[model samples]
Target: MEPLYQYAWLIPVFPLAGAMLVGLGLISFNRATNRLRQLLAVFIVSWLGASMVFSFAILWSQFHGHEPYQRTLEWAAAGNFHLMMGYTIDHLTALMLVVVTTVAFLVMIYTDGYMAHDPGYVRFYAYLSLFSSSMLGLVVSANLLQVYIFWELVGMCSYLLIGFWYDRKAAADACQKAFVTNRVGDFGLLLGMLGLYWATGTFDFDVMGANLETFVESGYLGAGMAAVFAVLVFLGPVAKSAQFPLHVWLPDAMEGPTPISALIHAATMVAAGVFLIARMYPVFEGIPVAMTVIAWTGAFTAFLGATIAITQNDIKKGLAYSTMSQLGYMVMAMGIGAYGAGLFHLMTHAYFKAMLFLCSGSVIHGMEAVVGHDPILAQDMRLMGGLRKFMPITSLTFLIGTLAICGIPPFAGFWSKDEILGSTFEVSPILWGIGWLTAGMTAFYMFRMYFSTFEGEFRGNEME
Candidate 1:
């Protein structure tokens, strides 16, 4: 049998196959019986799930220490430049792959029941498979150029998934907004990549990091140029992570399917920004102004996202804004030089946010499943109350998510948030204070949204 490392490419390839299968099924069986469509959906999801599990098992057995493992296949090489396709397996990439694949599996499983009767079932599964493949490829990319290619692929997948229900104008609009906003940041990142290539003559992360000190000392790139490049690269992270003014698209993104929201918040779209920062931390650290800028932007965005989440009556939208706030905390941690803390928070956030979104999906699913219902009920929490009586499992899970997000002790969020805050103190007292205030507001708003959605008296009768 071939070694697992040699066949690592098959992991992402399997999902791409599933996507092709589902896409073909959609076109060929558009008018097919529901049973046939359901079978195809199950087949696609199952294949992707199996691939993920197999990849995880193989990776676990081969796990060593922090050093990255590379498997490169050359595509092109010329005098001083080389191009290749390969994977880089390190602690960070391994952790991200696990989080993304796990969340994708859960969401895919949940979709079977949640989207059982939807007409677009085949199309939905195809998009989900594509999204999974893109994200998996992104996490494993060996070079910055390859990473950028997969980065754009993931963004494209996000747009498709978010606009899956094209009949809904809000969904279409949200997709456009997200695509445009992220494109602006991507342009900055592209420029930064060009700058790095010009200065160091390489896009391989390891090579760049190894020679970073020499490049700086040779005056090929001064601190001012480094700061400019860092800020430009960071723009991509800010937009993708939903920090500050670029955050407008996220709440509206809740108009998409709940699973898409879960995917965005947990492992795919939003995480891209923080992943960039973590990937390029050494380069950013060389520029003092760039580090400070990251810290301040994160502080402001954290506070702003938390404050906005408090007033939203839409449960998923509130959670969306809250996701932005939590992401800001992660970015702030990276800005303060707490890479481990940022990643720790990212892992915990993935679990809890995914759980929260799925729980909300369950609630929405129930509301729409009332006997003999005609029009689907809205997802607005203002119209929902006393759901605990109907959805005990969902309510409990959501409660756990709420507490986790609020940074309550003993929960996952508490550990991560504390580390970020602790690290902030070493960077700046003002930033630490701002982070604390954000934490308090996060608690207040999350609980408010929770109580209003699950604890209050029933405000509307079940449709029949």
Candidate 2:
């Protein structure tokens, strides 16, 4: 059973290998080899899906009800700092691993069908595999440094995937904007890492947690320093999670393919910020002012995102704002010392949100085929209506997603959001009130986008 941890690293390794294979295939093969490219793409995604199932089974058995699983592999050793690549699979990371990989697999499947005629099919699958592998590595990382490495890798893949249609100026611009904005957050995260190394003499999370009290009590780590470091560290979460002021890039990110949107917005990239907060829970808890700041920032972002979403006419942009709002809720939960609850929301959000994006993709594909347009116009809800009459399957799935995101009872979203609200109430009544208000606003905007997109008369004439 202990050896199972060694196999854990293989999960990410397989996808990385798949990515390399597909990438090389794309470069070597020409347009004449379209069939080969498609076959390779399918193989890469299939391998990743298989690896995820294997990893999940092992993780479930090892950490289902037992202690945290830690596996360390010696990497580079230097004076005063011994860097070892390792992973900590506790309840949190275990759950994240499952969510990321599963959502990624589903998105890839949806992509296969949606992008069947795309010229860059092989390139698309390669990027998808790379993104999944990076996200998996980040989730299971035991140290901040390792997490940072994979974090940047995920960002790079996001840039590539979002700008996949590089011929389109908007897609190129959106990718650049997202890349540059996230770099700002990454700078803050790097500073925090350096601060941690300076204070604790190590970058390992477990070591930092164990020695945090000693460092603080000895005055080596004061409240002011903690607060500053916490704020710097949280900058990454703010940008990555699409929190207020840094949230502009997310709505524009809809310029990418719908499948890419599902992968980035719903499953992996956006979740990285929440994961960071949970990873550093102990260190942040020791700084009261930092926690309060986190709580207020998250609450405000939630409200702001929900309000902005109401005004967005683009379907994907509306969902993008909704994602930011939901992520803010998770951040608030973490700030209020509800780590488990935040994680719960993250889990549920992954399922329903991915479903929503994929369903949107289906509708977009149908519209493209029906309208005989060179470029699809699915993003603009103003150009869409009566979709239920045209694509019944997609309509039903989209309704389920809408219901789930609205936090209606019996759906996954309701369970997670309620838990987050319950946790917020424990900390402050005012914060709880803000969260509830945001929830209601989320419901209103989501249904507005939904009804306007699918329930009204078709704004364009039917194809002859």
Which lDDT value does model 2 have at 267? 77
lDDT of 2 at 145: 88
Q: How well does model 2 score by local distance difference test?
A: 0.84
Off by over 4 Å in 1: 32-35, 62-67, 369-377, 462-464
Number of clashes in model 2? Answer: 0
Clashes of each: 0, 0
Q: lDDT score, residue 150, model 2?
A: 94
| lDDT tens readout by residue for model 1, 145-183 | 898999899889989988888888878998999899889
Which residue pairs collide, candidate 2?
Answer: none
lDDT of 2 by residue, 1-464 (tens): 66776567787888999988777766777564466876786788888887778668765775667577788888998876688888777777778878888889888888878888888887788889999999989988988989999999989999998899999998999999999999999999899888877877777776785676688888867867867877888888888998877887898788888899999987789999899889988778877887887888889989998999999877778888889889989889888888888889888998898888888777777666656543436566777888889888888888999999999989888999999998888879999999999999999998997887789898746433
Q: Which residue pairs clash in candidate 1?
A: none
Q: State TM-scores per candidate.
A: 0.94, 0.96
